[model samples]
Target: MRVHEMTITNDFQPQYLQLIAHRASTYRSDIRIRFEKDNILLDAKSILGMMILPFRPGTVITVQTKGTDEEEAIEEMCQLLENKTS
Candidate 1:
């Protein structure tokens, strides 16, 4: 398994956070997510699960992935979170 740390720079507000979370959820189905004051933990491949996390800007998030495609999953997730496209 692989784990990565990320920060949410955009959509720091509550409503935007919700939107981001929802969008992320739509991308994956069963992600595990944990909320923290400065960060979150996302279990790999759990898009839906990660979407429910209540996060704000500057929040730190840890993404963890397991399985044969763990690296790919982590990279994809990082891009999704960091990418400004939309």
Candidate 2:
């Protein structure tokens, strides 16, 4: 398993959530995002879950991924969460 923590810097819209879900679904690893303050943990591949994901700037999120491609999944997820790429 891989764990990463970072603050979200982007204001994501519904379309971006959909894109995130799509990207998550392409990976074999089990990806989950956790909001510590809210005590919420959601699967990245679930559209419904992604829809409610916290995207407010400065919100800290912890990403957990497990499985064969966890390394790559964590890297990509971090990039997306940090808004390092489009």
Candidate 3:
């Protein structure tokens, strides 16, 4: 497994972050995501699980991936977090 810390940018506010998280969850199931502030952890690939997180702007998040394509998953997730486009 691999873990990384990422900061939420202005472009990825609460709504956008939620969308990204939801998307990430859909793309990969062997990943775990945690909200930085509250340390709430959930399966990133589950839409319902991602929605449980109350993410906001400036919120920090920890992403962990474990699987055959863990690195790719992490990279794609990071890109989604940083990219302006959905």
RMSD of each: 4.8, 1.6, 3.1
Whose lDDT is greatest here?
2
Query: What TM-score fits each model?
Result: 0.58, 0.91, 0.73
Using TM-score as the measure, the top candidate is: 2
Residue 82 miss distance in model 1 (angstroms): 1.0
In model 3, the runs with Cα more than 4 Å from the true position are 11-29
List of clashing residue pairs for candidate 2: none
For candidate 3, the 10 contiguous residues with the lowest summed lDDT are: 8-17
lDDT (CA) per prediction: 0.55, 0.87, 0.71
Model 1, clash count? 5
Q: Write candidate 2's Cα lDDT for 20-86 as tens digits.
A: 8898889999999999779799999999889876777788889999999999998988887777433
Tens digit of per-residue lDDT, candidate 1, span 1-86: 67777777765444444554554444433344444563555553343544456544677677665656566666766676677432
Tens digits of lDDT, candidate 3, 1-86: 88888876644345665666666655543778778788788777666665556544578888888887788888887777656552
Query: What local lDDT does model 3 show for residue 77?
Result: 79
Candidate 3 RMSD to the real structure: 3.1
